[model samples]
Target: MNLCELLQATDGVLLQGDARVSVQGLCYDSRAVTPGSLFVCLPGLHTDGHHYAAQAVAAGAVGLVCERPILGLPAELPVVQVTHSRRALAQLAIRLYDAPARRMTMIGITGTKGKTTTAHLIASVLRAAGHKVGVIGTNGVCWPGYRQPLDHTTPESSDLQRLLRQMADAGCDACVMEVSSLGLKMDRVTGILYDIGVFTNLSPDHIGPGEHASFAEYRAWKSVLFRRCRVGIVNADDPQTEAILTQHTCRVVTYGIDHPADWRADADLTLLRQSDFLGVQFTVTGPDGQARSYRLPMPGRFSVYNALATLAAAQVLDLSVAAAQTGLQKAAVEGRVEPVPLQAPFTVVLDYAHNEAAAENLLTSLRAYHPNQLWVVFGCGGGRSRVRRFGMGEACARLADFCIVTEDNSRGEPLPQILADIRTGMQRGNPRTPFVEIPDRRQALYYALDHAGPGDIVAVIGKGHETTLQRGNETLPFCERDILQKYMKARSS
Candidate 1:
């Protein structure tokens, strides 16, 4: 592509050099620049990409897209100036990647929770219906034979476009991605129009410094997806549903258990707790008014909502109800109320509930199982709002039969201080609730498993599906599933 051709995709003014300079690639990181690459200077929270313009140039960046004037650059090098480099990068990437999202059905799922599980469910449904599907979200990007980890739920626009192009070239019929609030706010999904947009549920989250200024802003960003998609599938049961749908440009389809909607699960929901499975069985009535019984191998009413959303999307796509049943029945999401196979009398589940709303929802759902004892081992991440530590502590204290507080990616903060804040919340929630502090997460998991009684439901929350543990600027390999399997095997032996 020529420099002038790429500039046509962006609202950028060419400031220097030949418009016909050949462009082979695009980059944002100065360290990753290569020969004939166009480097985009993005303004960030921690540092400015403009400062590294010289570095990118030295690293073989042939042309530049920047928000401000960069001094001391080659007089002949191609330069384009844009008002917003992030948005410009998104537009340029879409053009360079051939607008791959337009070639296939695109599904974007957004919410405070359930985005990952819902995305996987929708992908499974698409596959069962004989459509090749690709999924991108918390679990990373994956298709039939490809998988890769991502640093963010919704990747940067450039990386996202490249991945979409790969999926399109690989013959995928549809793509389902988790459109995060930050992703929308940061213009990560800027140029892609979705075929279906889903809102699972919303709550107060991702609000603090370097994030949304308030809960209202966070909700508003989530609402942005509906405006960019052709159809909106939303959770009608949530009180914030109306607010989220405000200013939405798409046709609306709703799903809920307590409310009348296009898709709904009856009140006679069944909670399953077999020896090898823990899930919910419910009957859903679609827009056609045909009721079908479906069993999801995941627990809670929230899981039912996820299924409803998937079914609603399936209905819109004209997929068979049989496909919805088969796909949902076999779908399993890692770290989402995932049950570990154990020979012991007790059961252990893993989840990625790091904040107040998520923890409360998961724990409360488990409480409905009527376990002899509900044991929760969880902790808050470092450098986040102390309110989360307090909230998680309070929720666990009130809901769980026992609480085992532990470390969760302490990052650069001291473990003791984080634990202390949790203790404060625990005390506030229920001063009489008994609890123990285990600073090491590994030991914490060991303790929870070692002491669990028969018929007890032990939940290990936070850091679900994550492979590393961050502590004081160092990230160490850590897999909870491996730890649990090793311990259970040794104990059985």
Candidate 2:
């Protein structure tokens, strides 16, 4: 594309670039700069991209997209200055990628939790309805036969456009993605128009440095997705639903379990079982007066909401309810209350409940199975809020019959200190709750398993579906399910 055309998409001032220059590619990281590339200088939380402009130029970056005036680099280097480099990057990427999302039906799911599971449910429904679907979320950027791990729930805008272009090239009919508050706040999805925007639910999360400054700001950022989509499918049962929809420009469709909605799930037929697999079975009623029974292999009330939101989206797309039901019945999310098979007579589930709210929900869901004893092994991530440590501790102390506190990617924080903080919360919540301190997460699993009785429910929380443990600057391979399976085998033999 011509340099003028690209800069026009970003409303940027061409400080030095020739208007007729042909741009070959775009890059944010200086290390990825190639000949004739335009380097976008984003002001990140850790380091300023402006500092790397010199390196990008040295590596053959022909032009620069920046928020501030350039210095230190060659004065004659082509530069495009925008009010916000990140937003400009999104706009530039959309134009460069030929607006791939516009060519395909784009579904965006956002909230504090359930984004991944809900996205999976939507993809399943779409695929069952005979559409080739692409998914980008917490799990990864995935398509029919391809998947690559993602470092962010919503990737940077430039990468997001590139991914969408790849999906379009792969012949996908639709794309479903999880949009994070940080991504929305930073204008990562600023340019791509969404066909459907689904809001699962919201809670206090991602609040601190490098994230939202406050809950209000977080909520507002989440609402941004609604403005960018054609249809807004929201969880009507959520307390913040009204606030989120106050200024939404899209056509609204609501779904919920409590409040009356376009699509509502009735838990009257809901059944919780801890037999061979932990799961829930229920029925949903749509605005068309059609009711269908659905079973999700994944357990919990939250699963119902995820299913309902997905069904609602499917309904908006005019997909058959039968297809949605079939998709829901077969849907399974990894590390999301995932059942680990064992012949030890007790049930073991793996989940990624790292926060107080998620932990509380997970434990409460497990309690519905009426286990002989609900055992929980949980820990807080290192270098995060100490408040989260206390919160998770208090949640387990109040809900679980037995608690085993362990390590969870301590990063740079001392394991002992994190455990001590949890201890403080547990003491305040339930001083009499029997608990044990196990620093090694693998050993923590064994400790819980060794002490479990028949019909007991042991939940290994935090780091669900994660394959690595981060300590300081290094990340080592670590899978909770592998640890459990190996231990169970060794014990049986």
Candidate 3:
């Protein structure tokens, strides 16, 4: 692509140099710059990208996409100035990747909870329907033969665009992704128009410094997806459904268990079974006035909502009801309410319920199983809100019979201090709840597992599906399930 054409594509003002230079590639990171690459200078929280413009130039960048003009760059070096470099980068990436998102059926799932699970469900259904599918979420990005981890729920725009292009080239007929509020707020998904957008549910989450300014901001950002998609699928049971639907320009579809919606599951048709492990059987009525029964291996009220939204998405995508049922039955997301097998009579489950709301939901749902004792083990990450730590502690203390406070990614924070904060919340919530402090996560797991009596359900929360544990600056290899499996094998021996 010519520099002049790329500049025109972004509507950027060419402040310096020749526009005739042919650009071979685009990169935002200076370290990744190659010959003939156009470097996009993005403004970040920790550091401004403009400082590295000269370095990018030195690394053989022929052109620059920046917010401000560079002073020391070669006079002949092409410099295109834009108002917002991040937005421009997203725009440029779409074009650079030949607008791959438009080539496939793009399905985006967004909300405070169940986004990842909903995405996986949708992908599974699409695959079952004979469509090659690609997925991008917190768990990571996956295609036919490629799987890679992501640092965020949504990758930066350039990377996201490249991945979408890869999926398209790999012959994927559909792509499902978890769209984060931060991704929308940051304009990472600015140019791509989704074929279908689904909202699982929302709550007050990710609110604090460096995340969302307030709940209003978070909700608004989450609602941005509806405006950019052809069809909007939402959970009608949520109280804020109307608020989320306000000013939405897309075609609307709703799904829920407790409320009237375009798609819904009647309470009489819903059944939850928990003889040993939990499972849910429900019949969902789609927009076409047809009921499709689904049996999910996982059990919970939220699981039903996830299934409902996925069914709605499948219907919107014009997939058959049988496909939705088969997909729901086969779909399983790792570390999401996943049960870890043990030879003991007591059952143990692992989940990514790191927040107060998620912890409450998981533990409460488990309580319905009538376990002899409901045990919860969880820890808050370091450098996050102490309020979150306290809230999680209070939730576990109030919901579980035994609460085990342990370390979870205490990056650069003292483990003892984080545990102390949790204890404070526990004391305030229910001083009578037995609290055990274990700084070592592996040791905490041993304690939780060793103490479980007959018919006990031990819930291990946080760090679900993640393979590494971050402590200080180190990301040590640690898969909670793998560690537990090894322990169970040794215990059985």
| Candidate achieving the largest TM-score | 1
For every candidate, C-alpha RMSD to the true structure in Å: 0.9, 1.5, 1.6
**Model 3 misplacement above 4 A:** 268-277
TM-score of 3: 0.97
- In model 1, what lDDT does residue 330 have? 92
| Candidate 3, residue 453: lDDT | 92
**Candidate numbers, best lDDT first, in rank order:** 1, 2, 3
Tens digits of per-residue lDDT for model 2, 217-327:
999999988889999999999999888887899999999988899989885746567545877888788888888788888887888889899988998999987798788
Question: What tens digits encode model 1's per-residue C-alpha lDDT throughout 217-284?
Answer: 99999999999999999999999999999999999999999989999999877999964468999998
* Model 1, total clashes: 0
So what's the TM-score on candidate 2? 0.97
Cα error, residue 97 of model 1, in Å, equals: 0.6
lDDT of 3 by residue, 357-427 (tens): 88888888888778899998889999998989988999999999998888899999998899988988898
lDDT of each: 0.92, 0.88, 0.87
